[model samples]
Target: MRPGAIVIASSLLVCGAIIGCERDDMWEQPKTAVLGTNEFFDNDQGARMPVKGTVARGADNLQEDDLLYRGMENGKLAERFPFEITENDLNAGHDKYDAFCSPCHAKSGDGMGMIVQRGYKQPFSFHIDRLRNATPGYFYSVLIRGLRPTQLPGVKFEPDDDKVHPAVAHKLSPVERWQIIAYIRALQLSQNATIEDVPMEQRGELDKPKTEGSNGESH
Candidate 1:
């Protein structure tokens, strides 16, 4: 072959190999993308523990607030809430609570949730004297740190179980954990609510009782 032709052919072969290395999806390419199996590390999976000093993406706001994320101040339970409880925060908390807590703690935090009716062990009522007096950090700690094994007696719990909230609760962001704590406090107060606790404009509504018909319908 001519020298010029040989050089051109060799260049083409090299380019083809280089392009094939990137385009050969059938060979050595991960079945999944970033979340797929990764052979580069000892773990053959993409999901691995973060390295030292690895902070969660976009977690700077939460990470910096020790009380918010850790539910502690100087290694002790915070005496008060880490942030102000606005109406918006309370509303968001209601949704989170209903989705995660009501199944076990009930809408009223009375611990008589549907799952409990279906044979799951009953948890302590949030309105209990001890919990009513408990600090806000106490509930937040439960979500982040989980219940003590001794405190979980009578319940057969597995972290993998969907019915249980502890594992799922930990997955919640720091703000979300605190929101739930606020909602629980609100739920506790609701049980012992007095007419005076109702707004003055709404107080008249409390004076009237609903009349029930023979068919168990409210008239």
Candidate 2:
């Protein structure tokens, strides 16, 4: 046989062996078809049942804490916060309030936001005695379910009226809602605080004139 012919035949055999191995791999590759029978385990399900009590990632727990998740302590609304508010938490709450609540409720929580100025319905001021004294759970309910005005147009709301109508909906997360509520409390304190409410050290700071750049003002 010619040297070239032998070389060609050897190359063909090598190519054929490579193709055969690939074919074998294709046939023998391990993967179970969906719902197909498998004898590897007893009860033979190709799709194995998840291990008992295995929770999927990011899945909400079925047994959620009422105070933490729903802001309820008993059958009624909770008066206290679900978690303790730290200074950092307050700052986060302030940021969230500015981003979401300020457009409608205003940065001062006075219900006179830019939106209200633009003819949108003015919501109740957060500093109102009714609201300032409201339970945390009441605020949580309003944040989650939201308030809708049920009274007739131009009808003024009395202090004793049921103003928190939980009909409108908002999409804030529970934590974010709680944070905004904390900021609202802070705003209420800042707005209505008496001279006695301020610490002597802080009182002096308050009396000091606010200069340019005192509150992010341009120099």
Candidate 3:
């Protein structure tokens, strides 16, 4: 009676241990992730709501450079560019302006661009009296907050119902907007600059008399 009862008790104890070792479903169960929803949280949201002063990464830092990003200071259009202009900036500006602005404003800023030639609306010329008097921030504002067809007060705009005209900065960065402005300012100066506007070293060349070249060309 003692040996048989002892063996039966040992077998029952081994079976109980095996039952306790069975896997839990939690390892494979689906659960809500961050920013998701679940019934477990008091508010039924997975992630905790951001605190009152919280901001997106780097946004606060960008806010500090509002002159560069918003193109404004003291609620006015910035009087100057955020950084000093460089030759490299001009080159970048030329490329970006040609790639973006030249389609509607033309390489000459004359408003008769290829797009206009192809039946798009004619934009106001950069050389126009009002535009010529505009500041760098004015052009920056244009890129950031596109010129709506409605914004053109005296100009007749025939809108294309098939097209969606988003603001220029919808795809452009703040830096690119600045670069485009640089190219536009260059274009404006080219049309209105005087002889004194020439660089000191280049000014002397303007006074030199022209000579007849061998092939009826003026040099």
Candidate 4:
């Protein structure tokens, strides 16, 4: 065969090979076809299998509920949790509160934290009778789920891997969160308590002791 004819044949062979190598459906226009058993089988066969024991997407069984706000497992509400509020728990809660909540709720729980100082809206004071009357469960719910901005603007916090956010807006571990509730209760009582509510002997502890300096003026 002539060299030129040989070259033309080689080019045609290469072109055919290239066309064959292209994906089967690449050049074909998409067709609207009714679902068929074989097509369904093919689609499912190619689909990624879900990890073992993976719950279905959007399943309510996997949802964290208000029960978890108290750190109790769902369906086990009657059972007492292992952790309880101790003085140490309260202290740790105070630290966490100062780090996360003090920005908005303020150190005094008066809804006048530093954010409000910069012209942000203030939160309700924990000392309010309405708030003081609320259950610890209520506080836990608010802290864990966060108030929707549409419902109560700028109050939401996102949860983390343990399903607890480091901030008040995320879900906290049951015990640590309850400790925060205990501390808030203490703050409310301190600000809004009657003398009769206090024990008579311990009432003296509420007053500050007089301090005299070298200048003889009370400090």
Candidate 5:
């Protein structure tokens, strides 16, 4: 036999062996031995795997322990926080209320904000019987979870994007939330006050402060 013919025969034998050993199961459908949701093959063997964690839509995992309004330590509501009402808290609450609540409830606690001026449905007055009689727990629940929507215009939309929309987590801490509540209480008292409640001399201080320009001239 010629050397080239022997080489060709050897090559054919090697090719035949390679072809015969090749697995044709790559395109085959996976066989289900156990017909259950959790059963699946990994590395050609059945295995159960845990799913990964993901952020819920519109919700943020705020560190509650670090929050100012940390709910009860032993899973009970702390009706009275350790902090007392200071001038600083009142000031901070005033500023925060203006930024957040004032858009819906005006400075006077009347539901006549700019949105209402533009034809948005006015929210209920804070002095209303239901809200006025609400406990701190009720206020906190409403502020945190928000009210349910009953009709065409909803009170507040459900948070779906933690990034864009401001959740209760983003706005106020536990302490700050309480501070705002205190400030609201103060507002309510002031509004409900009679002539007997106001001292004659100190009443003048309640008037709006005069604004002065850089040159000390009133605009």
Candidate 6:
């Protein structure tokens, strides 16, 4: 064959090999599809069962404290906090409450937060008989799982489980959720408190004439 013709034939062979390499057959090579039937395993499930006693990521220490992680004791809602609460914890709770809860539940826990004023559904007042008597675990459950639309049929907020507040689910940690609950209790007490509820030292502050201005100057 002519030299020029031989060169053209060699280039065509190279091009054909390159084109074959780029075909989808490389990616479609033998492999089981997820959930696809596989006779190799006894159960015939392509997806093998996870190894026994395997713990999921970020869940290794979950079993350490049931009350702390799940807000439950003996399979029932916890009646009290899992850890001791200090003044600093309450302060932290106040900050978290104002940042997250105050939008819907209001800083005073009156269910009249700014969002409600702007047309969002008003939440139940924390001072109400039902909520005032609710256990701390109940609040913790709400923070973690949120109110499903069908969870509380006749409840005030009619919380949609799917529409869980992002801040509560993703931002606030478990300890932070407890702190917010403590702050909530404080708000409830403040709203329902009476003269007798005040300490003798603090009672004098309440009796002082209500200040008229931000500067605390008498009008």
Model 5: lDDT equals 0.61
Residue-by-residue lDDT tens digits, candidate 3, 1-219: 799998999999999988887565865366776677887868898777667888667552457787898787787777688788887888888888788888878888998888889998777778977777776776776677666657635434456623223477766777778877887888898988898899888998877776556442111
- Which portions of model 4 miss their true places by more than 4 Å? 1-66, 70-83, 149-172, 210-219
TM-score of each: 0.64, 0.62, 0.58, 0.51, 0.52, 0.63
- Which residue window of length 10 is worst by lDDT in model 2? 148-157
Extract clashing residue pairs from model 5. Answer: 58-160, 68-174, 68-175, 69-174, 69-175
Q: Per-residue lDDT for 107-128 in model 5, tens only?
A: 8787788877787667777786
Per-residue lDDT for 29-145 in model 4, tens only?
A: 354334422334446343445769897784433656535444344533223333566888778778777776778788779988888799776667788776777666557656765
Q: How many pairs of residues collide in each model? A: 0, 0, 0, 3, 5, 0
CA-lDDT, candidates in order: 0.76, 0.74, 0.75, 0.62, 0.61, 0.79
Candidate 1 weakest ten by summed lDDT: 210-219
lDDT of 3: 0.75
**TM-score winner between candidates 2 and 4:** 2
| Candidate 1 residue lDDT tens string, 10-81 | 999999998877756677665557678777778687778778987679663446677877777887777688
* Worst 10-residue lDDT window, candidate 4: 157-166
Output the worst ten-in-a-row residue range by lDDT, candidate 3. Answer: 210-219
How well does candidate 1 score on lDDT at residue 162? Answer: 45
Candidates in descending lDDT order: 6, 1, 3, 2, 4, 5
Per-candidate RMSD vs. true structure?
Answer: 10.1, 10.1, 12.9, 15.4, 15.4, 10.9
Highest TM-score, which number? 1
Task: Using TM-score, rank the candidates from best to worst.
Answer: 1, 6, 2, 3, 5, 4
Please write out the lDDT profile of model 2 over residues 43-88, one tens digit for every residue.
8888887789797664323436777666678877888987889888
Q: Regarding lDDT, does 4 or 5 come out ahead?
A: 4
Compared with the true structure, the alpha-carbon lDDT of candidate 6 equals 0.79
